[model samples]
Target: MPKSVLLLWLEGHLQSWGYDSKFGVRETLPFPTKSGVIGLICCALGEKDPQDDFLKELASSTMEVKAYKNKFNDKTEQGLSLIMRDFQTIGTNYDESDPFKNLMIPKKSDGTKPVGSGAVLTYRYAIQNGKFAVFLEYEKDLAQAVYKALQKPRWDLYLGRKSYIPTEFIAQGIFNSKEEASQKLRQLAEIKKLTEDFSVVEGKNCDDCDVLLLNDVPVSFGRRKSYANRYVSIIKKED
Candidate 1:
């Protein structure tokens, strides 16, 4: 089957996509990750489960992404946004008198049960002037569904986190092949004079880019999440 691509504009002041976290410290990638983009699509289609068949199908497909600054550059693409960190406290200021509020407190995942309430301060990272043009080579049916859903999303859409809502609608159009879709992105970028910051490519070897073993593939989006592995080539422009 011919591949279909999805174009999205992920502009947010605060967007954190952390696949691996230790303790309360979370970090963000400069560009959108595969799992992150997939998560966004599933959210639009109201497919909450990571184990959803659609999720699996998408994980098995080929995908590519590029992050660009909204501001036009001098073609050097030297301008990449810096990641800003936010320190936040979870489970803060709940009235002890309210019994229901106590239940809302975060708990340890010891598999047995949680005792008492735990609140901790954590650090999150995000990029400024974040804009991305994604080219997902996925199944046609799934792509069509996603395009339609974005017009009237089944759930509220956000980039990575709930607070990181998109400033613009994501769906640009569905196209055949990566080049055709990417061509559209280039046109838009040309008009806006956007500069590419970095890009991620899947499956194939990107000799010009650095390779990474990312654990962002979704096997199950359920409560007990499961993940598969995907290779990403990080291509950055020299400053």
Candidate 2:
């Protein structure tokens, strides 16, 4: 049997997928991560804990991502998008009386107040206006649920974070094969005048891949999120 491919359009003024981050500098992988993709699916289904069997099915399924440049620029250019860092800071701007202000303070695992404020300046990287085509292999029933949720999500749908909203619709359609679905999606997008700038697929289809270890697989994701380690390949391209 052939696999099912779901076409998604990811485009926004600012979007960030922080695969590995500690404190000061938060960076994004050139493409999306399995954790992020699974998270999106869980959120769509309104699944509180992402480590459930639903997520397990998604994580185990194959994901092939193709990142594209902004459509405004030359389509054939393939100039390669840029990952710009967004400088941000917290705590100082919050009002003392507002309960929301307390969020600026770091809390312990037990939710106890900290000794000092967690206010600090930091940089977050994002692939601005980047488009991506995600091909997935999942059971038919589950795919239908996901497609419905995406059309009218139980929660807000985001690229990698709540702040990054896709400019266009993310759920295009579901088809029997990746090629057929993608081809039809392109046609529809052209009629609607959407972006179709193709990007390199490092691990599955592209070349000169640099495989790296990523620990983004979800072990549990409700109040406490846990993850297991997995190997992923990074694709590099010329500007």
Candidate 3:
């Protein structure tokens, strides 16, 4: 049977998937880690700490990603081409005396363990060329359900942090073929509702070339020494 897949274009001014970050000088993991992606799924499902079975199911699923290069002109320079830097994350200062800090602290299951000691930290980043893409494989029924849910997303989608809202809808419907996926994305672009600028292209490893092209918008979070997040959306050019 042909596997069902959901092609998501996750772009924001700043996107951070810090699986194991330290208190000061937080670091972003390469690619979305199991814990981070699953956490987001749990939020979308409107549940926290979901059942073990649910977590296992999601963790066991196959997820793949690829980075791309993005080139654009810097507004500061007169038509000077600028290479946008990949998104990254910075750690926030925490008060050790605060009780809540301990609970929210990045720790391992043994509880009281530091991240670098044994904890796993994973983050996802794509090249800046507005060409990065992620491919997710799921059970057919589940994929369809997810696609439907995206049509009318109920939750507020953000880059990595909630404060950084998406310029366009991140979640899109499932498609039968790569052609179909590209068509849907084109339709979205033609409508002129995207939050940032972007383009769509074929997937490199995709057999059918089923994938969405995304151009991320640069955004910063917090004050002083803020990190950048890239926001992206599905779009197409008008004929």
Question: Which predicted model would earn the best TM-score?
Answer: 1
Q: What is the C-alpha lDDT of each candidate?
A: 0.75, 0.70, 0.45
Least accurate stretch of 10 residues (summed lDDT) in model 3? Answer: 74-83
* Runs off by more than 4 Å, candidate 1: 70-78, 97-100, 104-119
lDDT of 1: 0.75
Clash number for candidate 2: 0
Ranking by TM-score: 1, 2, 3
Candidate 2: stretches off by over 4 Å = 1-3, 70-75, 93-103, 106-119, 188-207, 234-239
Model 3 clash number: 26
- In model 3, the runs with Cα more than 4 Å from the true position are 1-3, 71-132, 177-239
Q: If both were scored by lDDT, which would come out higher, candidate 2 or candidate 3?
A: 2
TM per candidate comes to 0.85, 0.78, 0.49
* Whole-model alpha-carbon lDDT for candidate 2: 0.70
Could you tell me the lDDT of residue 84 within candidate 1?
88
* Candidate rank order under lDDT: 1, 2, 3
For model 2, give the 10-residue run with minimal summed lDDT. Answer: 197-206
Per-residue lDDT over 153-222 for candidate 2, one digit per residue giving the tens place of the 0 to 100 score? 8988898878888888888888777778878767865665445443433243434666667777776788
Tell me the deviation in Å of residue 66 in model 3: 3.2
**Error in Å for residue 109 of model 1:** 13
